[model samples]
Target: MIKALFKKEFIDTIRDKRSVVAALFGALFTPLLFAVMMTFNIEKARSVDDVYIEINNADMAPQIVELLDRESIFHAELPSTGKKFELNGETHTHSKISLTFSDDFESQLSSGLPANILINADYSDQERSSQIRRVKRVLENYEGAVLNMRLVARGISPLVIDVVDLEEQDTSTPGSKSAIILGMLGVFILFSVFVSSTNVAIDCSAGERERNSLELLLMQPVSTFDVVASKTINTGLFGLFAGTLSIALTAVVIPFIPLHKIGMAFNFDLEVAVKMWFIILPLAFFAAAFQLVTTFHAKSFKEAQTYIQYSIMLPLIVPMALEFSKYKHAALDYLPIVAQQQAISKLIRGELTDFTPVIGGMIVTMLFSYGLVLFTSKSLKSEKVVLGL
Candidate 1:
């Protein structure tokens, strides 16, 4: 009986072309956008192009000028008018940054006094801060070279200046190294559940009520529990379909992401996909039950939409909040959104030891979902609720 009702609801949901398209689009949303943005940023960071800065008293600091040139920074005449220009297919703009060597630059260096190199840029203007930083780096490099030379000339070891040496040794395995970058994928997977089920949940609950078919369906021999179960199951299937496609699309899209350039790698494979599926399986039901419960309380189809849109944001918001916070607990890993994120991230890094956490999370999420289904089923038996009052 539940299968008959589920098949009926599922067929009705499939007929909504706009809703299916939206679900498909939502599946591709994060991977496509984040990939493009990250690729552009990585290419920009790695490619070295000439940065032009105005130089004053160039003759007084020939060594500094040469050092700057070697670093691909050079002096160039600025156009009097334009603020931006295209160079080698990349857009660049004059930052109006200037380097001014003091009048007594050579004298100060020879006398072992501090040499002043004034870097002039609008400090408050955030847009040109990168130019300002690049200029400062060159000056600091020159200063370090002079300091080493002075120490060696005085029969002192150049190493004497260092009280301690600090070196970094990265212990991150290739799989674990990209956890931060790939954590976003875990988040998108969970959010896709709500995106896929919104239309179906609203249609099965609020849409039927608005069309005056909800009352007629209740007049049948079927119990309200069977009706609730059928709707929740159908809605969850949509979420599952969207989630599966999201994983498949992400798997295809991840190869193109240049995580290697940033010393990160997405260890996506069949095993990880299988683990992620286990994590999202219960999330599908959770999202469906959550959506249906909220939509069932609405007075009309439009109100259901308003409620579902706001209610669905819980998936996006909870992970963002807990992930950013410094406080973390073992209990949180057993919760819904946070659990899926943690589980998927561990699975990506190949660090998942056992199915304990993910399976526990599945149980907790399903319990909440089951509770919502029962509550909604009980409400449906009421005359006020079935009539949209």
Candidate 2:
């Protein structure tokens, strides 16, 4: 009998265009958007390799120009009027960086006097800022070499000027460095579970009430527990479908992201995908039960939607806030969304070994889900909820 009710609800939800569209949108849109954005950012980072700048007096500092060339920065000619310039027959907008060397630059350097080299660029432009910094660094290197040569020529020990040597050792792995991005990805994955079942939960509860069919269904021989359990199971099945699709799509998309270009690595292997799907499974049930409890209280479909929309903020915000917080409470590992996020994050970083937290979280999540299911079943017995009074 419960199976028949579950099949009915599932078929009705499948036939609803709004529900199907909502589910597909939740499953596909976010992963595609993340892939496109990451690809664009990585390509932009790669474009910084060949930086072209204008040199007003290239002959005055051939050595500096050679240094710039070695650093992959080359000279380009620009018109005085417009921002558009051509390189190798390709029209390109040039950066504002223009180098001007004083006529006495070589002479001043030869005499150990200050040589003026002015760098003119738009400092506020983020794309050109790195190139400008690289140019300045190369010029400083040239100046330092000349200064050391002058000191040696004067019979002064160049080592006398050195006070301290600083050495840097970075111990951060690629996975550890990409923690924040992975945390956000985990949030989106969990969010898919909550969002995918929202419309279905509303339609089964409030929409059924609004259509005047809920009371008639309640008058049947089946107990309230059976009815509520059927609806919750249907909704959770839909959430599970959406969550699975999200994980599969994410695994496919993650490899295309050039995280290695930025010194970060996130491997969404088959094992990780399976583990994530496992983590999200209990959350699917929790989401469905939670949504059902909230939606069953609303008098109509629209009211339920409005209420659920606001209520959904808790799931989205809580995990994200915990991810961004500096101080983490150890007890959070046994909570619902927080625990799942932390577990997935540790898994991505190759740091998750103990499954105690995962097991604890799953148990707590399932218990909470069943509690909501019971509350929803009890609510179904009330005349006010049944008749939408």
lDDT against the true structure, per candidate, is 0.83, 0.86
Whole-model alpha-carbon lDDT for candidate 1: 0.83
lDDT of 2 by residue, 1-389 (tens): 89999999999999999998898888887687778877787788676567778898789889899999999888887667777877789877666689999999889877778889989988988988888899999998987898798889999999988888778999888778777667667777888888888999999999998888888998889899899999999999888999899999999999888888888888788998999889988988888998999899998898999999965675688776776886577777788777787787788777889999998999998988889999989988899889888
Misplaced by over 4 Å in model 2 are 49-58, 69-99, 119-132, 148-162, 323-328
Candidate 1 TM-score, true structure as reference? 0.86
Model 1, position 5: C-alpha lDDT score: 96
Model 1 stretches with alpha carbons more than 4 Å out: 44-52, 76-96, 103-116, 121-131, 146-163, 172-174, 321-329
Model 1: pairs clashing at backbone N, Cα or C within 3 Å: none
Q: Superposing every Cα of model 2 onto the true structure, what RMSD results?
A: 3.6
Candidate number of the best lDDT:
2
Model 2 alpha-carbon miss at residue 316, Å: 2.5
Evaluated at residue 298, the lDDT of candidate 2 is 93
